[model samples]
Target: MSSIEIHQFMCRKDNFGVLVHDREHGTTLSIDAPEEAPILSALQEKGWGLDYILTTHHHGDHVEANEALKARFGAEIIGPGREQDRIPGLDRPVVGDEHLILGEVLVETIDTPGHTIGEISYHMPLAQAVFTADALFSLGCGRLFEGTPQMLWDSLKRLRELPDETMLYCGHEYTATNARCALTIDPDNLLLRERATEVEHLRAAGKPTLPVRLGQEKKTNPFLRADDPDIAKAMGMEGADPVEVFAAMRKRRDSF
Candidate 1:
């Protein structure tokens, strides 16, 4: 069993600030530095000192508090090697497909560009979780800001290859909106409908609807199901390439 404990909280409007703690090793790390105050509060509450910051991208909202947290906790920042120059106080630059051991836990970085040209996702197999910062969301994927639809689609495909039981921890709390858009594309999906209702209730209760299972996302998230014939048909593009279907869905979501 995994001994790692994960604490997730909202930061800077919709961005999520996450802390991954290994109790046995007394190692505590954060996913991204969305803000400094809340992160510090969380660390204090948990009585854990920050040891590392695992950055998924170089976006301002994601890395805005990098230097502040580093200065306060002396945490080492590890980020995408491809965008190392963009991230502040980056001590370790890692590329996709590279494996590193931190606090006795193996961390695998998966290149998930499309949200940004150099975005990456951190996957911890033993912990059964993947932090897909901006590359993928619950029922939607990030906007293609610096990459092509093909690039985003390919990145999502790689993420889909993870174990079905793996939990997905995304960068933002956009499930409610994404769920609404997902139903429009896959209206006939019974699972999607159920998930949409669930999302609505979660938001109404002001609860986080994240850490969703990859298996559930694969069945309900339209972006991940772009290749499904039913989804393609729903979009009026039957037998279309998965990338084309994915592109159409992303474009529609952009305006949604």
Candidate 2:
């Protein structure tokens, strides 16, 4: 480990962004910006200069502030290759499986195209963190907006193969609401039940319930545990493949 620093900032109440600052490498990478005001205020209040803006997808809330921040800080804008037209001022359009270098940190971009046509998640080996934008949330996942449900399910499966310690960081503060939805499907799930309790406490105390570990997610998040028998059974399918089970769970969550 190179002592990477992760700062989670709650911008605009619901919208969230992350700043990964590596002091040893002297580089700071800013995740998607739902709005420019929060990004600018964060940079000023925390005395951080935005070096790069990594957008997960082309949604307005995700990339709406892309152009403004890039012009102000001259930061490199990295967007998924599938959305050149949707994302603004894309300095680098990366495809899936491309390795992105951020100073001493190497971030592997995982193309997660279910939420949007060009959605991608950033993975860092050293930090054991994944910025999963809208593709996957704490207890739920993003809706199938562009790609098929199968595409999103496959993307999440690939991410699940990572080390159990990998930390998940999403684009929004939807943990509390997501946990509530997960309970409907897997109420007896020990991990989910415990997490709901914990999340409630965090929310009441006005704290962030993100950067959850991969091991923890596997135990609770139905979207990530499609292979689990309980999840498949809840989906009303016997021996249903992970993709089918995941799709049903996503559909339920969408309506939840």
Candidate 3:
């Protein structure tokens, strides 16, 4: 079986760094550099050299190490076309539905404009994985930075249409915190309760609780389960549309 190797690094406070290695093609892709030192350190630890830099958006937390990494690695920078000017070190601007090969894996871009106006999530159908930066978290989604509830809602719906078995790698280590908020929106949900317990234990042990499956997210994550009846009632907004419930939940989390 052919599969890409994924290395998730803790780059900055509450931030992430991912390195995808395609052994068959001898190329490596780093997703969203948060800081220079940690990413370089992680690469050195893995003994991997970067070939490409994939930027999901223009957020500083996501792209602060772009310039330095590109300078050091001499790698091409791929960015969302909507905000190429904002995304530093963007060498290649691509739009939604574009297909490109990095090593042996083929990556397809899916525009998910909610956390940022130009946010784009990567879908690797061949590998059955995705690099969802800040758009969809484990138990929640990102704060609506430059888009609307409708925009974010639609963006997640699009991601949901991917293969149910898709492996999700979000941009931050916010699952435990997000899962806490998820309980407020899905108090009696058995899946949420179980997921919370698992996440809590892992975090208590100082372990990572990420790379949640899409199928699991559909069942337990309140942000992804906005249409579920239990989630609606728990949010104190039964009989409401999914978007309405999601918006209210987001508002509550923003204050929490």
* For every candidate, C-alpha RMSD to the true structure in Å: 0.7, 1.4, 1.2
- What are the TM-scores, per candidate, against the unseen true structure? 0.99, 0.95, 0.96
TM-score of 2: 0.95
lDDT (Cα atoms) of all candidates against the true structure: 0.93, 0.85, 0.88
Lowest-sum lDDT 10-residue window in model 2: 38-47
What is the TM-score (0 to 1) of candidate 3?
Answer: 0.96
lDDT of 3: 0.88
The window of 10 residues in a row where model 1 has the poorest summed lDDT is 98-107
Candidate 3 C-alpha error for residue 241, in Å: 2.4
Model 1 lDDT tens row, 1-256: 7899999998999999999999899999899999998998999999999999999999999999999999988999999998999999999999899998998878999999998999989999999999999999999999999999999999999999999999999999999999889988988889999999999999999999998999999999999988899999999999999999999999999887
Best first by lDDT, ranked: 1, 3, 2
The model with the greatest TM-score is: 1
